[model samples]
Target: MTPMNPDADAVERAVARLTAALDEGRPVAPVRDLIGEHDLAAAYAVQRELTRRRLAGGAVVTGRKIGLTSPAVQRQLGVDQPDFGVLFADMDVSAEAEVPSWRLLQPKAEAEIAFVLKEDLADGDLDAARVRSAVDYAVAALEIVDSRIADWDIRLTDTVADNASSGLYVLAERRLGLDEFEPRETTMRMYADDVPVSEGAGSACLGDPLNALAWLARTALEFGDPLRAGQVVLSGALGPMVPAPPGTRIRAEISSLGEVTATFSEKSGKPEKRDA
Candidate 1:
């Protein structure tokens, strides 16, 4: 699909708009107006430009994130493939720290499995075996997704250009080897303030979390930035995402992978207490 606006100019406009929203801590209109709703190529162009700007600003690439792994969401977006976003070092917030609410707009939380690579996927068939073998370990993680678009109103292109609506991520401490557990068979249940909020199985993520990794390795290779050794890969959500408003405590337990938690700080940066 051709962008509603032209190529380079449209990408520049999209980058500028998203950058402003991030810098000012406010959401803007959907960028689909500039880039077409279905022009994934144009959408990714905007993403690359934004990544470039972040790099110029001293940000370092930490890893990558796979989004739209749910088949239902993919069908809704009219795409057969999942989209990805670059993860930066600043996005990591371990469970020990409170996630500052001031750092996000329209934040939501989802449980996922995160893989740390032990080999480069730059040259290979990039099949399931290769990607799975490259994993050094897997851990439970919480992805705090946020949108730069106002009210979280976004289409495929809009979200893609906004770095797949990335915000902060919290990782659990336990590490399990592939032989220690089966990803597709794992079950996940997320809680907000000790109340169960969302639940699903590992199969929710592209049939298996490893499948998501394989797809990302192949796509990242095709895009000229293959998954490298030591990079962390968030293999998409294991369940439906739930809104994470300020002063909320989120905890996700994934069988075999253990649990991860994050408490969203109030605007004042004070940690919120869990419900009694």
Candidate 2:
């Protein structure tokens, strides 16, 4: 199918609708009809404009998050590759703080490894080894992914335009060096309210989380941004995501990397129905 060529006005309208939904904690209808199904380029442009608006509104870009690196997630979404989104300062949640569930729409939780870089990584020649060398440490993380697209009925273009369906994240307090830790060997088990719900190994993330990081480094450069020092990169999920609702406590324990927890509470209002 030939992609639709959108003008500046169309992109602006799409961005405005999405940003409003995000701010009001509501789900918006799929924008494919507005942006066109095959116009991924224009979808990404909309995402960039939204990011720019968020930055202008005082949200700092702390890092980036990779999505769909796991085969399980790819299969669930019927997609074959990964996409990414920028992480803002407000998206970082404390491990001990209670996440206001009412502030989100259709939230889900995934176990992941987060990389904090100590050195800048440029655009080209990014490999797992190169990516590993640039890391400061890796922490066990829980990524709470929420979608503005109602019912999470999103195509690749839909999600990419919606910031890869990214939401808030919680990182473990403890950090581990990569010298003794192997990304592929790390095992992860997630618990909801202390009951084990899902489990997987780091290899599920594109063979290794480092590979996901390398992919993000290369892809970010293509987007005119390099992996900067001190930026936290979410390498991707190690297992399936579990539904997270108000008053639920989700915890993730990673082999050698330590554990992280996210507790949700009813802060605003009940979650709106997102299923189509």
RMSD of each: 4.7, 4.0
lDDT of 1 at 175: 98
List, residue by residue over 106-137, the lDDT tens digit for candidate 2.
89999999999999998557887788889999
Per-residue C-alpha lDDT of model 1 across residues 1-276, encoded as one tens digit per residue: 222334988889998998888767688999999988988888999998888877877888989999999998888877887888989887888934699887787999999999999999999688888888999999999999999899988889998999998988988999999999999999999999999999999999999999999988888877888899999999999999999998999999999988899999887633222111
List the pairs of residues colliding in candidate 2: none
Worst 10 residues of 1 by lDDT: 267-276
Each prediction's whole-model lDDT (CA):
0.89, 0.85
Which of the numbered candidates is closest to the native, going by highest TM-score? 1
How many clashes show up per model? 0, 0
